[model samples]
Target: MLEIKDLHAYYGKSHVLQGVNFEVGEGEIVSLLGRNGVGRSTTCKAIMGLVAPHGSVRFQGEDLGRLKSHQVARKGIGYVPEDRLIFSGLTTRENLQMGIQKMGAEALWTLDDAYRLFPRLQERADVKAEMLSGGEQQMLTMCRTLMGNPKLIMIDEPTEGLAPQIVTQVGDFLLEIAAKGISILLVEQRLSIAMRVSHRVYVMGHGQIVFEGTPADLEANEAVRKEWLEV
Candidate 1:
């Protein structure tokens, strides 16, 4: 559903994503794993057109390198940023309403669908987003993106700073979403979370994809794990 080839991005003069390449097939869950500051986030930002990148970014065979961020979003791409940026003042329902786009009659996600995926959100439907706990906030962030009805959703660090039980819930939610035919591009630091949720994984180091394979393949290859992921 999405492909990036020879991707290079920069922040000012510092090169971030250098010759990065990867792909996410339809209904597939692909995790991008890396430690802090390895350009994992930058790659997502570039794909969403939030950062300037000098490389090929194709979504469903359409070139997306020059499109603006919202344009990319309109082209069936949803993004849940690392920082779950819920409106402090808006109610949970209101925050979700902000993601609705007026394009298709067959909406990909509705209130019912979101509630089914995250029942806690339904319980707090009328509450302000800021009053929710960290796990609730993360769930809300993912739901907000899903409301846009994206064919491919890119989630950044969904389990960061959450309790273990909540992390497990989020992992199950992602797996369910993938089961429903939503292609997922997951950027996560938690290896276990990535391993549990993704069908395939890509290990990034020094701004490039050094390893790409099944989660089982990653676990079996101790050398790549130690070389790219060990602290």
Candidate 2:
């Protein structure tokens, strides 16, 4: 339901995303995979309008070229940043409440669903956000964004800096989200995790998409894996 064509982004004189193009269909999990500095994160920022972008960012056939970040979000796009931007001062429940939006009569997600998905969130519902563990904080951040009931969510490096077990949990969480019919554009560096959860994967290098295909296609292409993905 989201399409980007000839998308270019800049940081002053430095150009980071050069004609990056991709699409995320409804209820599909598409992973944007690449090593650091290839502009995977920058692509998320550009799509969210956090960075200035030139060219087309069309969501549901509407152009988002001139819309501000908040405006882009209002159009049913949720962005979960790499840093896990949670409100340290607010309680977990309060943080979830902050992301609430007016929904159509057919809203698919709710606080109840979040609690059901991650029982830890419900257990710590009243605890201050900063008091939670790193994994818990990450869960809170993703759940909080779900409170908005977005059509598509862009998650940037959701498993970064977390323990292996927690990384597995995050992968399971992503699968659960996808199961509920939400489109996802996941910016993940971990190939195994991306392959496990993504329906299709796009490998990027030098600020451009070098390869795009299904997870099985990626597995069979050792050269592409070595050249663009393997560290």
Candidate 3:
């Protein structure tokens, strides 16, 4: 489980995340939704320790407020950024291989599992990552993190620029990941996919959580959507 309370982050004097609070239970999918500049991504960065954080960020009851990004990762928190970072020169197989732990405990996913989720990855397994399409790159990015065997994965915009069909594929993948017992914290711009895959949704505005509830509860609240989510 992961817990964040009164979480705040700053870029010099510019405050980004202000008093954000939320929790992601084991095997549950939680979506963080809001318009641009509402701090949804900042919350992910803060939780991943990519930025300096002030306030509590605990995972499995251990405090990680002061930990570095890599340290946080070592503690089982994987991050898949919106940029879909991958080694351009590396083959798809090599990129995926990079994520697998050569030692330590066993991971919950494998290249075979990733191939099953996204067959394109398997098709281009020996091809350089740079040769893959945008959707394929995103799939690779996510699978690479899964290779890390995280208890909780904070994914920022998994379906951002993909086609509608790819979006559906990614949404199904998120659901499958949860079914396999990996907690997901998805920062999504697409509310439809989020609602379909998540157990609950949290809407953020001006750097704070303005709404938190189940999908049905969110659907019934049009005012919240108008103010914090709808563009």
| Per-model RMSD to reference | 1.3, 1.2, 1.2
Off by over 4 Å in 2: 103-105
Q: Residue by residue across 1-231, what tens digits does model 2's lDDT show?
A: 999999999999999999998999999999999899999999989888899989899999999989999999999999999999899999999999898885556667778888998899999999999999999999999999988888999999998888999999999989998898899999998888999999999999999999999999999999999999887
Q: Which stretches in model 3 have alpha-carbon errors above 4 Å?
A: 102-105
**TM agreement with the true structure for every prediction:** 0.97, 0.97, 0.97
Q: How well does model 3 score by local distance difference test?
A: 0.92
Give the backbone clash total of model 1.
0
* Residue 189 local lDDT, model 3: 90
- Tens digits of per-residue lDDT, candidate 1, 1-231, equal 899999999999999999999999999999999888999999999998899979999999999999999999999999999987889799889988887774466787788888888888999999999999999999988988888889999999999999999999989999889988999999998999999888899999999999999999999999998998989
Instruction: Using TM-score, give the best candidate's number.
Output: 3
Compared to the true structure, candidate 2 yields what TM-score?
0.97
- Model 1 misplaced stretches (Cα beyond 4 Å): 102-105
